[model samples]
Target chain A: MPTSDDKPTPNTDEPVTGAEADKAAEIAAAKAKAAEEVPPKNPWEEKPVAPTHSDAMDDDDVVALEGLVVSADLFTGAVTATVDAEKILDVCRFLKEERGYAFLVDLTAIDWPEREEGRFDLIYWLHRHEDSKRVRLRAILGEDQTIESVESIWGAANWMEREVYDLFGVIFENHPGLERILTWEGFNGHPLRKDFPVEGIDTGAAIYPDVYPPGGGPIVPEEGEGA
Target chain B: MMNGPERPLFDVEEMEISFGPQHPATHGVLRLQMKLDGERIVEAKPIIGYLHRGTEKLFETMTFPACIPHTDRLDYVNAAHNNQGFCITMEKLLGISIPPRAAYLRMILAELQRLASHLVWLATHAVDIGAITPFFYTFRERDEILDLFEEYCGARLTLNTMKIGGLPFELPQGWLDRCAKFVDAFPAHIDEYETLLTTNRIWKRRTIGVGVISPEDAINMGLTGPPLRGSGVEWDIRKVFPYDRYDEVEFDVPIGTNCDTYDRYLVRIEEMRQSIRILRQCLEKLPEGPIMAKAPKVLRSPEGMVYGSVESPKGELGYFIVATEKGTTPYRCRVRPPSFVNLQALPQMVKGSLVADMMAVIGTLDIVLGEIDR
Candidate 1:
């Protein structure tokens, strides 16, 4: 699907006339013909381009990494590539080794409980010192899918992957020490999951237990645990 | 009754110790699970999240504007950059361009916050290594910066002064004069700090060549700010990816040669000087115009993703925001906190070093547990 970064479609506020539609089509065809004949100009010769928010991958880079990507979109100047969950390791390796994206800026996931494609979208942001540009890679995973770890590619991914596991409950295949970094051991639920309660879950660790009731009360905990 | 080979008095094995979720020198609520072999650190694993309040998860439930206050809580010491990163991401998502005046004002506040943050780092780092007088001198200058923040925004520490489109308010009357005054005298105070710790024998012994990280290793480990710069990487986001009016300002990105704790200290001190340079230029070229853009009060961003980062005091503070179609709140907001990523190198840096040097390494990393845990 064309995302927000694509050129917006024509406005339909007014009823279209057949003559006007024909004219618009003719103008578009002429413009396309003119573009085909003209040679591309050197971007370096033009005024220095201002920095933009869109981090979308170039069309050539997407085509070069074809089989690995499931889908790709650009929005608000940021490019996002969606790859298969199982291929994440190889894809990240390619980006790191061959592409010189040495710095793993961040590794995070977004939980979408309602999405049919998958329950979570794991995102990786990488940067290169040479070019000073960032590329965001994403992979959609099913509710039970286990992702291949990128810790081997970038050591920085070690703690980041653990944090993702702790908050989103998405398992990683080869993380060194796959444990909670934010919440402690024996925490009841994955806090960042959409299903988790906003007010908080009944973890049975509430303070001032006598003042509130159980199941999200001001003070109460589970019946047996509190006293 | 010793043996022929001189029998040991005690059993020789790696001893384990927990270094704070309580100790003062650990900075905040950071706990390090450390293994020691006769005062030499076998390994150190930094266990964070003692200050975690689920800030990223909280961003999903709050509106775009409401999220600014929450960002302030992430890196509490250098809160303006947090606000700036979030606001920049939101502005990118919403396709709003801030006015020139607002951008310049943001640079001023961010630079001032940098000075204040480095002061805190210097004060604490010095105290950790046995120097205490510098703490008083640094905090004195830091207080004046906080006063400027209070005059610009009502609050000092959690200055939620930035909005998505631009700053929430313009500079208060006479605020620029006071800020200029603060920036002018700040360098002299930094010199005072350098005099105390830069040449002192004890300070040199505690910091020089301690926690050395090679430049190549620093890049691969994803270090930024002074830690990465201290390793001679010379990668500052302001120069590489200038945000706000940083592109217009004249300043140098100070880097170190030795890649040691002393180098990091020198880098931070020079950074304070550079911030003063930037602040002076900004104050001189202060523009006149609207402080905010003409944006809709109820922001509904189109479906897309944008990552915005700034050269925050700690490192590159970035916000990766994913917005759904017509979404009021961000779909997923990921904060790439510099401290969290930089602190990953602690184990690598502290290995084979003396147990006492661990405190010096931790202080040199200049971590704020709030940012690490968030």
Candidate 2:
């Protein structure tokens, strides 16, 4: 029958009614309780804490290769050692022979075109069967520098070295067959380099060459012109 | 002269042949350049990369979360493992631990995907070895698993169902019951497959003593999954690394002694049974909790690199991510595709065997070209 606005307005000059004052106090108390009950911000809502690289100098494995390893650090509980590009072959041999890291889990390269030290970071992940231990070796190489291949150490490095060469254009000297792998024999450029185009360049191997010109297929009209 | 020797009729010479970039027996665009002494393979060189789409380069351009779908396309048949591998690596880089329920749910989906992948392998491997009936039988069961996947995530083949810290969506109502039912009935189907091929004289004669790789050579070739286990090496990423609550579940790592095509086949069939054991455990112990972890809206990974792997159906599928400080996109994301690495051993396996046995070797490897050429 009545609306909320029909309630009388409290005045500073007039003494407030007891029931109304109690009700007002109760409302204030409920609001305070609600404010207090608000949960802490979830991890997603807060600024995430960035992980820091920790020194792995004290690790036994890193210490085992004291002279060969330039520096060692731990990332996500895995030991990563930076070795000279020239000594990658030696390091791999030592790890495989002496350290019992018989398995070459993976070999890949990361391109850093703008870095002052080198243009690429070559990574080799090795694993040991006993105790299931793993280690990652990082080798820095200049754009024109060639790193010795570890294919002789671990037979598994054959295609992996080729893949690194195919993708990043890193030369693996003495690699049995270092020709392009993922790409054809005469692919113009290494597609994995940061400078390469994401949309892809014209490889001149277009489908239906007679019907559509090289780099041409099913042309679409301009944004507003298309239906 | 004709009675003296048949050798004088013709001069013996080796033949060089290009096997396939299109042939079905090679399985998805793999070409093997072979130097053969008559019908025996003297040397077989695997030439891959027909399906390479520069997926790693694409990962560099996309944000951390955006790369999950791209991983699905790597091993298209085993997309769930690919997604899990990428998500686990990203979580490691981001230092975000997912909720328990999410972990169990991931295990369930991953095991189901494993079963589906093995079924595909068995069907194709059987067909490749000249038994056509297993193809129909295996695919029949595989479709049910795919239907379960479709019910859960709406995509059967390339399921981009996982998220960085957890899952994209919680299970639909009655999804677990359906999955449980499938897991329960899957062993009998496996038995049916074994009855058809395990002891069949043709299958045994074709597979046994064919493509035999010694344990040392298998490890030297960096083989994983059944191929490595087929060589009698008891190694599994789930048991070794224990990602995604694999530590909580109990399952056996099936190994084979002979290291031939038949042993690998037995290893995979036993693996499907072990996957059932894992699925049963997960379905029962799926705890009630959040499906997603407490993560930032815009995921930013710390500077450095991390390699995280999962036991995909083919082998040890890994994602190696190198992130810049607080970078949303990976500086470099290299996928250690199991098929790509395992396919490297094809030449080793096919060598010194008959030309027809090459089919059995390729089949035993269980390599998917999408992952191999990615």
Candidate 3:
């Protein structure tokens, strides 16, 4: 928590002269080496191994878990994983407790719509509070598919799972409440599925009505017309 | 006997009321189905996505450059933050390093954007809690920020200033002076906001100790931004990951222990102060160099993936992009919006509180449903 009180002079006030540049370069080299040696782990408790920082990483976050190509790297003191999910929760919990990446940032699916096996990828971004590291876990599940559920670690995953299920049609097995989140009952398609049409506009999110009044009320209700 | 017999036929003392989709407090077209017992809320359920445009699906059809502006609409209040996140992702995928000046200019724009965004938050939050005059005061400062935006970028609201690599142009002349003045004086204005709300009795009664979340729960639920920091988790991607020149800028990451609505409000106010600090550091240290990255105008990345992010006012705003061998649209583009993740903790935040406090909890969460629904 570096405050103005702590820092008397502004950091940018001094010039980055040749000596300072040399110092920075030297620091960068040493720090980059240290970053590779051991990644940052849980901070509160003592650990046998020293945790390294993922600062100078180049293609380091990606992890190859059992027939899947995914990367798990630390971002902003949080572990953010990039996954091509052939496997989901198995890989996620491994990072969760074993690696201390306890928090589940979010569970989402991105639709490619163009590629074949890579048409849809399920993404899970996890965070560890103790170490304050983030790792992303992903499963490359195509459209019309289901992936593993991680309601075991974070109870908050239930609603997120429901939203993903409702929006992307990527089912999560064993979720306590894996029901539609935003969409109404008997709604046709996974509205967020890439190929799904943005049609049947529920203008004003109006509810469907029964009479000749149509499903909702009039499209525009006006007492009189004026330009 | 008559008094006993005079009891109403039906016990209709309580009623279930749904607010929003039309109400004033919702901000957007959000509906809250609340079960109330005599003006006290018993249960509340947020029926969301009244404004869903399926932007994620739409991104699949559009090219990378075109998607940046659409992001502006996601969390409309923090449009530049959204634009910055996308531009960073695009730049990373192509493996292009932007000029030093562009990064500095970005810091200035982003900090000002933060001020404007917080101004809106202050205005709206106060209005929600019955402070009438603060909105006008905050808006006056907010207009200055918008004027700064108009001076730099042609558009004020949805500023599509960022190009694929760096920026379409450089900062207009005298921009730095104006920004420096703003950063220097912004702290006093923030102090003014605090004077109006922070210690005010009604503000505290309504916010402090209301909708409290513990640090453990906040981390477990994946809450980020001020909400997570309010619970004492010192995690901010700008400081942690250090994308662009965020490493060059020096600032503090503010945290709170109480983890309540008031803690969040305090954390946000402190964060604005810190943003001003970073802006000053960036402006003084800004270098003279090209603004754009030296890459092909019509850019294409080698087939792979890149996830780029910035520490937005809300939280970690990240873009997950997968580029294919074919040099065209991205194979996949996923925006991990902070507001979306922050909203996940809402049900947890409001479970034990009175129904009206649910709005306070949600308001404190500071979610823009567009990002939540996007």
Candidate that would win on DockQ: 2
Model 3, position A110: C-alpha lDDT score: 70
DockQ of each: 0.22, 0.47, 0.13
The order of the candidates by TM-score, greatest first, is: 2, 1, 3
Which stretches of candidate 1 lie above 4 Å from their native place? A1-58, A206-227, B1-3
Clashing pairs in 2: A44-B295
lDDT of 1 at B137: 93
Model 2 reaches an interface RMSD of 2.4
Cα lDDT tens digits, model 1, B136-224, are: 99899889989888877889999999987787787778888888778778778888888898899999999899999998788778899
What TM-score would chain B of candidate 3 score versus the native chain B? 0.93
Model 1: lDDT of residue B46: 87
- Looking at candidate 3 chain B, the ten consecutive residues that score lowest on lDDT are B296-305
- Point out where model 2 deviates above 4 Å: A1-49, A206-208, A215-227, B1-10
* Alpha-carbon shift of residue A219 in model 2 (angstroms): 9.5
Q: B128-238, model 2: which lDDT tens digit per residue?
A: 989999999999999999999999899989999999889989899998888888888989998999999999999999999999999999999889999999999999999
Query: Across residues A1-227, which tens digit of lDDT does each residue of candidate 3 receive?
Result: 66866834436868767877797799999999988988553221221221233632343334324334444554323344555454566676666666676777666777767777666767676665564555666567766666778887776687788887888777788887677776765566787765676554444443434322546455543446443
- Which of candidates 1 and 2 reaches a greater DockQ? 2
Tens-digit per-residue lDDT, A31-135, candidate 1: 999999887743322322233344334655567687887777776555678888888888888887888889999999999999999999999988877877677
TM-score per candidate: 0.87, 0.91, 0.79
TM-score of chain A of 2: 0.74
